[model samples]
Target: MENSIYQVYEDEIQSLEEEIKMLAEKYEDSQQESTFFSDEEILMSMKSFQTEFQGELKGQESPSDLKAQLESLEADLSFLMKFTGIWFTSHSKKTVEKTGSRTIQKHRLSGNCHSLPFQLEFQLLEIKSKESVSAVITDLNVIMESGEYSGVSKFVSSTEEHGNLLPFFKSLSSYAEWYEHRRCTFLHFKTRYPDIVKLPEGLLGDYIVLRNPEPSGFELMIVWKIHVDEDGRTTPVLDLLTKVPEQVLEQNITTIENAPTCFRSMLLLFGIETAIENLIKVVGLKK
Candidate 1:
């Protein structure tokens, strides 16, 4: 009877193991499908937001309506940030002087710039317990370098809205990482495909323009802009320009389909090496 009971327990355990394995396989498959669908959905949502934002500007939409749209866009972007595992934490420090005492708390996030990891720092001045805060961002710093260039650039808020700083911090961090990734990608591309990719001369103002001269008379110009949004945050925007007219072009000229939805999304969809390779393919500049 003891042996029989032992055998029955062993059988049950084996059955449970098989069930768990099946469930695990199903979960992995679901996760993979979800990832692909989520990427496309996010890209489409961002493109739609950019379009509506442009229209609102042209139509002179009311402040309240614009604010609502901006809020919605921010929420969507925050969701993307969380989904991609790009997050921030609050940092606090207390300072005491002969004159007065002050506390400084900032939101900080970090990412990799090629081989180097860097942090973005942001702070809001004059905070109270629960009152609505309307003051501009005290400081925004990107501590990262690309090639020989290394320094911090201060960013000022582009909007006057007073509220939480999480959205702004997330957006700025996303943009900073995107810029770094693009710079790294450009460096790699130049090294691998030196003949096809050439950076422009002189100052370009937050834009990296690469020119590819085709055998034909027309040239292919790929422009990547570190675009600042309504909330005074930045993101990478890509545009493909050729001599061909809208009717002749294969894709929409003013759309972000040429670019990743965000830096985190780029990394999630394609790791650093694959992302660059995919960019080359998307731009149709591969030799």
Candidate 2:
């Protein structure tokens, strides 16, 4: 039974590694295609289509030609949905009668990123009075029902990014990607070293405690945190917390204090598993 459980964790690690690779490739493809996440990009696409439609109308007055053009536009919109994992439920545009020349369009969209669902509502304004056309987004609101991503909730309540939707989506994907990566990594190590590692709060928790095989009551804790900035950049921060016995602390105060920084440098040069394994060996040698 114990062997089977270990196999299960190994399997999950392999699966997560595969998924991470797939996600990276897919996101890169989306970026290369320039998924329309910003109002400015959308505006440029809309203007291009508008110009093409006008030329087509002047050249070919046939209803069949117009239907074909509409079909092409629909296909482009479908590509946008597939690339960004976003789907629009309602989209409408109207010319402000009072303004006489301004166009205001409202959009409602919802989508799932890495299985996390979210909704967005916003308005796009196009100013045609100036010689240069510009797109402005306003009244933007974000809704994420799932509490799995706490960072998303803070974004939903904050007004800082209400006018911009690009960062919200970008950060959401990045943070969730890192979260999954951390969970997989922790699970893999815990299952591999069940006798040495302890997870006080299950696999979903942020920190894992490692104890040597000897009953010296010495412990090393690894804390992993995912931080998302206001600009929607996601970063992973790792720290080492040692709980050394009084005797050991007094005997080797320098090693206990220097372990954290050395571990970080090892993480840069050798990676997580080797760094952790080396630490385990060092602690296991203490008699």
Model 1 CA RMSD to the hidden true structure, in angstroms: 25.3
**Model 1 misplaced stretches (Cα beyond 4 Å):** 1-155, 159-168, 201-217, 232-234, 244-287
lDDT of each: 0.51, 0.72
What tens digits encode model 2's per-residue C-alpha lDDT throughout 132-219?
Answer: 7677888887777636566555655553356866677777778767777878888888888788878897877778898887877689
Give me the candidate number with maximum lDDT: 2
What C-alpha lDDT, on a 0 to 100 scale, does residue 240 get in candidate 2? Answer: 95
Which pairs of residues have clashing backbones in candidate 2? none
Q: Which tens-of-lDDT digit does each residue in 1-287 have in candidate 1?
A: 99999999999999889778766755664565345345578668756765566645655765556557878987996787566545433223322111112224454557542333556566645433455544445566555443322112323233223432456455545665665667776777777766555667323233333333445322345556666555656655554554444443445544334443543366567765665455555445522
For each candidate in turn, the TM-score is 0.33, 0.57
